[model samples]
Target: MSTTPTSTLRFCLRQWSAWAPGLETREAWSGWDGTLPHGDASPKVDAMPAMLRRRADRLGKMTLETLYAPDIAYHGQPLIHASRHGEATRTVPLLQALARDGAVSPQAFSMAVHNATAGLFTIATRTHAPVTAIAAGPETALAGLLEACSQLADGAASVLLCFSDEPLPALYQPYADTAEAPFALTLDLVAGDDFTLGTGAACTEDATPLSLLHFLLGGETALPLSIRGGWQIVRSAM
Candidate 1:
């Protein structure tokens, strides 16, 4: 009856940033008590170009806000963007328009893809490095972390791993298996011994993007993430 994880991954966390309604500051997030705030307010995107900001949806704005946070010094490292539902707001509307009127705005169609926000981020920052988009249902964050570690193992110096998602549109709310709120979090990961990832028993809590943030901020020894069969990240004892 051994339940300990057999496989493990170790990595360093250089810098981190997170954004959500009423929890935009490090102080606010540090005091988070597992309660999510309700709001339509999205993160500010003034750092992005006017054109890019104008074209970006709410999720895109959140991504830009977290990525370009003044607190973190992001210098165009390779990026891994993960989301459970990418561009659902835009994609859902496009699908509805297509079904109802047989017409979809070309602009909307272009931005409906999962990589649209990633593309926008790179364009805004003028980062020519590789950017990978990941959508692995509930395992999106885990997948993004693995991808970042893989790149580090392949000789990259650093990688920016960002997890961003929002509540699905009202049309798909009924199909939602778990409640979600709008949030974006980024961790600048490098090669070091800051944390370890491994498998464990399933978790019953709401394992949304914010959960990862809480785990990192709360100083927990291990976070039992409800991902894949089950996965967890343990802060390194070193």
Candidate 2:
């Protein structure tokens, strides 16, 4: 039998912020009592300065809002931003510009890239600490969590993990495997005794990030998620 990596995540999930269509995420998340709603999420990032807010697309705005979510001001460095499709909103426009004039605007090109939000977050907060940006198709969240756990194991005090995504650009809409409505969630994790995380090879219907979100926000005792190669990401409260 092929074996997969397994370890106890051993982290205190201090706080989280999530937003989705027609869902007052703050209120619902405060209690973990609401279902994932359907429809376009109302995009609003009140914490960001107006100018910088305007510069970012929907995904960027969500990531920043979740990063700056109330009361997470003291979290340690090394923010992890995970997504299946990164900066897709601006991808089409950039491709169009390339097709038309063989040149793309420096400013648009910068914001449309995958690392744009993480880069902007550092500049906006003036925190030089490291930030990781990851894009791994449907396995994005699983991979991101593994990386974050590894970092914490390496002695980092805490990590801010944000999984955010929006619909693929219209030009590539048919390839989407996630919900039509965009979703963003951030977790402030620090190695502790409050939680235990484990993973193995299995299958499930729920998406990885969503499965984790529901478990944490819902206070479930166990969670199982599907991954490529028949692997499973499992969790339980300690």
Candidate 3:
């Protein structure tokens, strides 16, 4: 419950793009009522080259679509891609194939790794900028955001932060503890003081990527998060 500005992390959001079923537009997402929508919501990924698009799974497509969305103008900024479960849907099947048939396709094995989507993005865009992939349980989004902000503080002009997750397939649904839909969010962030992330009161609310998106969308003045030792994001005082 310590609200100190001295240790606050500060940054400015240049632009953001989010994609989900029936919530592709900011106007549509403004109506989100804390309930994730249910539907196909698969990303088109038409911007990706044909070969890459064919190789990308649903989650990969979602991530690429958000990063390449019309609103996001990528200028080779370093990328930090985060997901609580990176390509889980793809990995599970690979595991099953190994268990059942005692072997799996080598090509599929390559894409089943945690950094597949990030690698695909770099290959597609031919970006030489550094790329970092992260997976930190439920704190995945916060970890990615913090990394981007730290890059800015370390002399980087800007950073591209992306988070993507989809509902676990039916086989793993029973083990799921949190509610989520097929969604991806991309943020173009630069050095500034428009917002602050600092220590905050403890609460039960989880700091899911969707929660961060709502705060960025101006739906809330302060985002209360109970992860990573209790944190919050708010507009810096003028």
Candidate 4:
């Protein structure tokens, strides 16, 4: 009973790379921090504020302060924040502490939530606009994009879709071996555009996580595609 978006949205992609250990830097397609190679080179626990600034730098000429400033010209758009593995690195330590002492640091618990990045973004940008956080396993990226498209269809002027994922702890390394990279994309709907929505069907079978991810990033495909139980597929800009 839902209607599709009549107009398409505009989007841009950003990524962080080389921040995970045991993973080659070439595997990363986004932010490329040199921390992975050095075992003891973890960014300071309180360096998130500065890291956000550095990540925001990829936007070119746009600073975190300017993007999140109160008087900025955001025009009240919606947001979809995505992270397949949200702050896993930060949570591991807290989990270890709780396992040993039956109590955890309140700050660490709060900071490990899936929406932590979104909260920080809101605080830094000083924007009270609607925001949604999604953690859809490997499909986090597509899920976030779909939500952004939904907002645009519902008449939102714009939507900022951000995705980030850090490396897991050594104990959880068996789950995935991908490099640490955070990718973010900001999308805005506009009328009278030359691009057209792609078409495809999503089905759940035995597709690799990276394959699905590549499909989303490749663009220029049809929708209605089947996605696995934990995965999602949606149209993207060309």
Candidate 5:
């Protein structure tokens, strides 16, 4: 086998919030220590008005909840929304409609795209900062982090990155390969003069973005993150 070199991107985690089945509050999550939760997501998106709430499905609501978690100050910063399978829950039904030679609903089709939720977020929050939607198979979270870090290093004060995904529909489960459940993790990141960010090559199988998220929630200042390209990314304490 050919050996591939490792690379890393770094930044400081300013704030974060996550919503999984069993892990709801920061206190409850911190007590669990790296345990992955199962089931549907019921994020606290109550800040959103009732009209806007009806437009978003379970996943979108969870994404917005984490993205706007009280810990995240949401001050018109750039945003990166990453998902392994975006809007698949909504699109699968549309596909079945087309398969049956049935007319597709315009509203459903509009919300079926990958960036649709991001658009809704910008509109709901009334923030004009740049928003990027990303889907990179298994490497989505790392790709989103790199994008945010690049923005920070290039001079932006802060960046917001949110990673969310839902379980694939039963009809599509055979083709879907993802470890994600109905979950959303948001991080408000900043690059500063202090030495708060670093990266390195990784060999461990558990060094993924979601895994690192659990570690970080457990009050870890340093974490090992791995992507699909066989690279490890690490963050060190100040």
Candidate 6:
């Protein structure tokens, strides 16, 4: 016996932005507070949340009511939230307090979890829709994409996929590596598209500083293409 294929999911890129530590992200984007060990370090660290807030604003007018609304309509659909090193900056301070014999703030500890972003998003949008947060070290982006596709395959009417990452803290500067700018994308599956999705594994030879797979397909809307090398997150676009 053969099984019937599931309905195809269509993703539309609604909003996206690539942010660096010191770079001006948006009019409302704010920077982090603190000095860096290196003069060339990105100075816009504190502004990450503001940038995300701004993105949310541009997508649609965000009100206090809408920010905390429980209906899924505000989010367009259910969501899949992904981050590489989620709230690492936030975690650093908690660790410091533990070392200094300072009482760790419960609020801070709660916010430092991997799913904090998704939780905050739910609070901001008041959407009760199901949300899944994923962290797969260096493969964070690909894992997120695959999970979103899986939700679609599982019969979700639609799904929103978001990806973001920040630079490692100065205390952890020795491990500071890679040049990934924080970014987010919201994809909605729709009917009528000639796209196909598949996966494979192999080493990549691309000389780009960060993963090329992310750069090419890290948005809500993008065309499909043949991708070779490395473990890739694949999505077919019609």
- Of the candidates shown, which would achieve the greatest lDDT relative to the real structure? 3
lDDT of 5 at 47: 81
lDDT per model vs. reference: 0.81, 0.72, 0.83, 0.47, 0.73, 0.47
* Residue pairs whose backbone atoms clash in candidate 1: none
lDDT of 5 at 172: 78
List TM-score per model, in order.
0.91, 0.86, 0.93, 0.58, 0.86, 0.60
Which window of ten consecutive residues has the lowest lDDT sum in model 5? 1-10
Tens digits of per-residue lDDT, candidate 5, 119-238, equal 888888887879898987766766777788788889988998899888888887888654557788888888853223334444455354567576655554444445344554433434
Instruction: Highest TM-score: give the candidate number.
Output: 3
**Which digits, one per residue and each the tens of the lDDT, describe model 4 over residues 125-176?**
5679787978777555456665766675577655665544545667788877
Q: What's model 3's overall lDDT?
A: 0.83
Tens digit of per-residue lDDT, candidate 3, span 126-170: 988799999988777678888888899899998999998989888
lDDT of 2 at 215: 74
The lDDT ranking, best first, is 3, 1, 5, 2, 4, 6
How well does candidate 6 match the true structure in TM-score terms? 0.60
Output the lDDT of residue 11, model 1.
Answer: 81
Candidate 1, overall lDDT? 0.81
Provide the RMSD of all predictions against the true structure, rounded to 1 decimal. 2.0, 3.1, 1.8, 8.1, 3.5, 9.2
lDDT of 6: 0.47
Model 2 stretches astray by more than 4 angstroms: 1-8, 30-36, 74-76, 229-238
Report lDDT (Cα) of residue 174, candidate 5: 84
| Quality of model 4 by C-alpha lDDT | 0.47
Q: TM-score of predicted model 3?
A: 0.93
